[model samples]
Target: MPAQEDSSTRVLEDLDAAAVDYATRIAGASGPARAALRDELTRICLPFAGRMARRYRGRGENLEDLEQVARLGLVKAIDRYDPERGSFTAYAVITISGEIKRHFRDRTWGVHVPRRVQDLSLEVGHASMVLTTELSRTPTPAEIAARLNVSLPAVLEALESAAGYSPSSLNAPAGGDGAAEFGDLLGGTDSDLEMVDDKLTVAGLLLRLPARERRMLAMRFYGNRTQAEIATELGISQMHVSRLLSRSLAWLREAMLNDTLPRWEGANGPTDPHGMQIAVQSGGGVVTVQVRGEVDRDTAERLRTVVRHAVSSLAGRGLVIDLAAVPLVDAAGVAVLLDAASAAAVAEAELTLTGAQPYVARILGVSGLQSLMR
Candidate 1:
């Protein structure tokens, strides 16, 4: 035993010397030099880490994971340690133990408990074990609380929280017969089945729209193509695309809410030199209007007109204005959205603004029209 003690003391002294040297070299070193020194220090400290990790071996975590945690803690301690503070061994032990405790606190909790309660539980557990050994009897909560200089209620709460340390698996056996699993006894209902009729109705409605409108909807939503890309493909101005899109969406909104087919007015309409393009699609009792280009003083009235048309035509279905492609929106554009929202409210229909670009969203946010967005 004396020989073993002598060997242990020598090993500790050597490790401490090595730690101080690494700290001094790492302080002056940079780039590859610092990295190599850190690697060497880590190797020297690994055995200390393993020793610390062994303290937590019987816990739920794998021994290897705990060792890795301890090593990480050692690396951090090495980086942060000042040789002036004291011996490396003491600092390493504290840092390594803290890292292991943190791992257990963060990862092992089956249910979330307050950090204070978790810490108290650990203290209470350790104290109870010590008291039980000393007294040769189980320690009461009051005794543990007095020993720890805490309230009895706090001790009781900590003791109660011990059960949450390890949660039962969902796959565990449900009963003593072992015929059923816990998961088998649980019940759930599929909510998606409720929307089948609505989906079918929307699919039929989509089929009735003009071929051009259908293609535009497919490209915008399915292909995820920008309005500019769609405009380039169709050889039309982005503004023209916006208007066509809006008018198309408004018509579909009217049809779905009224449960009637829309009369096809040919796609050709009066061109605006400074107006946004609008595309509309309807499904599942909601009509989505895709607006592109700028919405400022010049084009705000056009937006109001198109949205008002949609609101007027719909009986009860909701309308969503999508502004994902609109690069800019000003005060006038915000007014148009507010007006549309108010009109929808009066009509007893919900209006939602969807996919506004950042600049456009910021404008709406400043104007307090953000509440209308979904």
Candidate 2:
């Protein structure tokens, strides 16, 4: 025991000497020498930062981020450390721990909390640690309140706020075998499936429409072809095309609201086709395609087909695709748009996109398609 104590004393003395040397150099040196001394000091104290950071592990924040925070705190402590006032290690531990606590208080709260409550939460935590150490047991809220000279209710509130400091991930492992995630145990309806149901209902309703009306609707909405173009293509007068479009849209709206359409006859049911409604309108040498519903791999082919048909028929006129009603667009859908744009460019026609949802717009921006959007 005497030999061990001697060895421990020597190690501490060496650390103290190093700290003093670093401090003296840091204070007296200038320029490159000062930077070198700071680097040396940081290297010497890195282990202390790591030790302090380890105390904050398993608290939701990444270990690497916490270590970085602790290192920052160590640097601050070293710059401000007064050897005449205290031991360097003790000062560093306090500063590093404070930094970790501050990180939790400022950033880790999943919800907004009052500043008073946030500060109190930290105080309560410190009190609990002190009480736990002294009593050799986990401290109750009442014990912590007494130790901190705070009311029991305040302590309880602080304790509650502490839970917000580290919200667990829903994807975290839950079951013993780790086969299930915490999200699997949570209860909530899948909203995307609900959207799929609505789309399927719409598809069923579309199937009820006549083939001519379906083709006209597709040309007007998806091909961005005007009533004149649709009429010319269908061998009908412009007035008749307008009347047909109005009637078809009204029927679709009523069918969607009242569920008046019969079920789809497809073997795979309503959502099997997983297609979107595209209406094209052409007038004054411009074609507009209005796209509705999700645009993913399954629906992208239909989009490509309609756009290609419209671009071919437009004779170099501009094309505008309105996507206000499109809730989602995947990579395949984006690819289809890019390919259509390329085709239109090759045909010496201008293509403009409008009414993209924020998410779709972000995707377009990221994919370098923002230049094509109007």
Deviating ranges (above 4 Å) for candidate 1: 1-9, 132-137, 182-374
Error of 2 at 256 (Å): 35
**lDDT scores of the candidates, listed in order:** 0.81, 0.80
- C-alpha RMSD (angstroms) for model 1: 22.3
Supply candidate 1's per-residue lDDT for 327.
65
Residue 356 displacement (Å), model 1: 78
- Give the count of colliding residue pairs in each prediction: 10, 16
List model 2 lDDT by residue over 1-374, tens digit each. 99999986776676577888887777777889988887888888788788789886765679999999999999998788888977887788789888888887787788779888988887777677778889999998888888888899999998988877767899999988999999999988778987897788877777776566688889999899999998777665686577567867877877777835543211122343455788999997899998976576557889999999989987868998888877667767888999989989988999998998887898888987899886
On lDDT, the candidate that comes out on top is 1
Give one digit per residue, the lDDT tens place, for model 1 in 94-130.
Answer: 9998988888899888988998998888788878878
Range of the 10 consecutive residues with the lowest summed lDDT in candidate 1: 264-273
